[model samples]
Target: MHTSVSLKALALLVFCCLSTFAGAAGKCERLVATGNPEYPPYLWRDPQSPKHLIGANADLLTLIGEELGVKIEILYTGPWSRAQDEVRTGRVDLLAGAFLTLPRLEYMDYVHPAFFVTPSVVWVNKDKVFPYSGWEDLRERTGGTLVNNSFGQQFDSYAKANLNLEEVPSLTQAFQKLLLGRTDYVLYERYPGVALANTLGMLDSLETLEPPISSEGLYLTLGHNSACNDAWLRGQLAKKMTELTAAGLPETLLQRNLERWKVQQSQVVAPPPTQDDSQ
Candidate 1:
């Protein structure tokens, strides 16, 4: 009886120790995040290094990492279209900038409230003015936008069904088409669109419509399949996101980065216009 009791006590102690170790194990000590490299003021490839990402999202994530006591590496693994795939496959732990969509939820979880809210706007050459108040205004006019870009599910559906829109490989192509008067209008986020226009030195030629077409929140989302996607980590991220939102950190980050982006654009040489590919 004494032997049996001693063995039982030993087993219980071992189980307790194991549980403590698991609870204390640094499973989420570090994280990797990535996103579209072309999105300025939010995320973009480091001008010096294509492998690393930089911008407001990177700045905000660094702050988050400090708050959470974790090391977060934001990288630009590839093209924007493939960024989601990298996260979905668990090669990337988080998408530093993402929109919450039903399709995306299947692969990852959104950490709310969003880190930023950006408005998708219509951009037209100063010479190609058109009467535009809403999405319906574009039904009769042809528009160009970046492929794989989503304003929102509703707008995405509407554009597919009613709008005459062409998808190009990059926003650079879309802007080039607009500059050349090949497309009636261009659709893209307001800040990035303006940043692109400034970088291209076409701010005088292009103008964004007031009352944006659609506004979407940009979030820090964790891939469900990521090795670091633990409940504890997710919970902490959600809490931190909420705190950041309440503290207006997102808005501050956006505003600060907007100026930073403009400064960066001014210092760098813009790429030459690309061939029109709005088919």
Candidate 2:
């Protein structure tokens, strides 16, 4: 009789716990976002697994999803261009991270209080020196940069008018051109440049110049035509993101993930220890 009563109590407890969890999770079932899989120390595709993306931005998004009672999946859909296309078409609900662009505004609504900001820096080969103080300094040099990568509204306008840059397929390609002396410099984010350079074993060969070409906020936005776009969801996310920013969550995550990447990358480079043969 005692065993029967205990079993009934346990079942009732499980039912109540499940009901509470469902009530919380009902706010948002899931949110999908994708962008620039090459970007690191912010976002990037895990080398060990192509389908999963890992980095600072991914960590922060996970926290945001938890706060919203939703599952935020950062998928490696394709190249940066394809991800942007998906977001624009509303086939994907969100752009994982992006800068504010006039064109993007037409198809997506940016959430309030951007999660982070990053600078577009110029990286040059160590032996090839260019004293860069501003964008005008780049006007004379033939640089390489990824296609569809934007620095900012003002910088983009100026670069289009005055800068001579060869648009490559990806950051790695652009950096390769710079390394091979095909391009004078490469335009990319500072952290990603450092991360990629380290990954490529080119850390000793490259240097990032100051000042940055332009610094822009990295944001999450909902596609305008998304069937799941809800005003309440947008407002809730905005509030939560702002609170997260105030708590310095994104910055903290970036540092932690940066260290994690270092460890992971080192493990990749090192060979496994051989079994002892002394016995």
Candidate 3:
């Protein structure tokens, strides 16, 4: 009887030790995030710190890390598509800014109550402007946008069936194509497009038509395979995001970054106009 009792105690001790180890191992101390490095006023590669990302989304993530007592490092992983791939494969813990879509839900969990709403606009050269009152007006025209970029489910599906859009590797190339008359327009977010155009000295030559193609929420998503992903962290993130959005913090950050981008642009020389694609 004494042997059995001692064996029981030993089993209990082993169980407790294992549980403690697991709890310790599961505890998260830091999170690595990534996003669209070319995106401005939302996220962009920090010129001064090329390996890191900066702007509104980065600022928001920093605030979230402080609240969660976890260090959040927003890295410029690569282009936006590569960044998404990193998050999908668990190489990164979070996407600092991502638009919701059915396929993305398979690999990441979007925190409820998105922190920001972004408008996707149709950009055309000022001299090449057309009468664009709605998405239907864009049919038959050649549109260019970055690879793997989405406006929303509805527009994405519609565009696939009705529009002729080209996928480019970078916004710089897309804008260049539009400016050089290679494409009729470029579909991109208003603020980032404006920021990039201003930086490239092309703002004077471009214009956006109303109304916007889509206005979608920009979410902070945790990778499904991330070691740090757990009920506690998810709950805390949702809670914090709700409170911050209610407080209207995102708009403030965006405005600040807009000016910040302009200041940074002022320090650099703008890219020269591209030659016509045919030439």
Candidate 4:
């Protein structure tokens, strides 16, 4: 009887150990991306539905999550400055999409290669066509930009030293200033500007100046301090992103987002037409 009781206790211990191991193996925890509340077509909060984030970058991240078999969450922390702070302090695991920079490299590891290329375009009022071919062409014009937006390390330096750039709190305000003739021109990512313009029904009011100022590819950045900082994980993500790009994922995602945007736009009820007195 004593021997049997000892064996039963041992078996119970073994079972508990196995149960704990299985629970850990099934754990679905992983680092996710976070960023500012603006930056449309790349990242942005929906005007009509603030909780729903809509854009190309968001779609791309969703695909990445699906490929990795993990859940991707978006944590909005305010502007780019604060969001970068979160990643730096390990408060967040990733910054969904970012331009590769030497300074950023110090605190984070970028997934190998970039998934999408974005051009920095100058937008101006349609009535006043500015012949801006590049940064040099914009020397004489006053530019408006988001407060924490970095065009690139080099461009940021040059703009700080030479250009007359007014830093605004948000891109929408920057575009609004441009439309109100408050600023000479607004410089931002081409796709984001186009997406915002289309959404605001102001696409016809603004035009992208010929020849982009500069272009940069965007990458997913992983915080160096995060538990998900394993080289194998990075390698897997890089490989998946490359495969998606090869499969023409960016274009496909853009088309889907555009269609969704159209649906959302159509859902907006128009004001009832006034009865004409002459009729």
lDDT of each: 0.82, 0.82, 0.89, 0.75
Q: Write the per-residue lDDT of candidate 1 for residues 68-139, one digit (tens) a residue.
A: 899999987665657788899999999998877777889999998887888989999999888888888888
TM-scores for all predictions: 0.87, 0.83, 0.88, 0.78
Each candidate: RMSD = 3.4, 9.9, 4.2, 7.8
Q: Order the candidate numbers by TM-score, best to worst.
A: 3, 1, 2, 4
Question: Which sections of candidate 3 miss by over 4 Å?
Answer: 1-26, 269-279
For every model in order, what is the number of clashing pairs?
Answer: 0, 0, 0, 0
Please give the distance, in angstroms, between residue 211's alpha carbon in candidate 1 and its true position after superposition: 2.1
Q: Candidate 2, overall lDDT?
A: 0.82
The number of residue pairs in model 1 that clash at the backbone is 0
Q: Deviation in angstroms for 248 in model 2? A: 0.9
Collision pairs in model 2: none
Residue 184's lDDT within candidate 4 is 91
Q: Comparing 1 and 4 by lDDT, which wins? A: 1
Q: Which ten residues in a row have the lowest lDDT in candidate 2?
A: 270-279
2 versus 3: better TM-score goes to: 3
Given candidate 4, what's the lDDT at residue 40? 59
Candidate 1 positional error at 163, Å = 1.8
Clashing pairs in 1: none
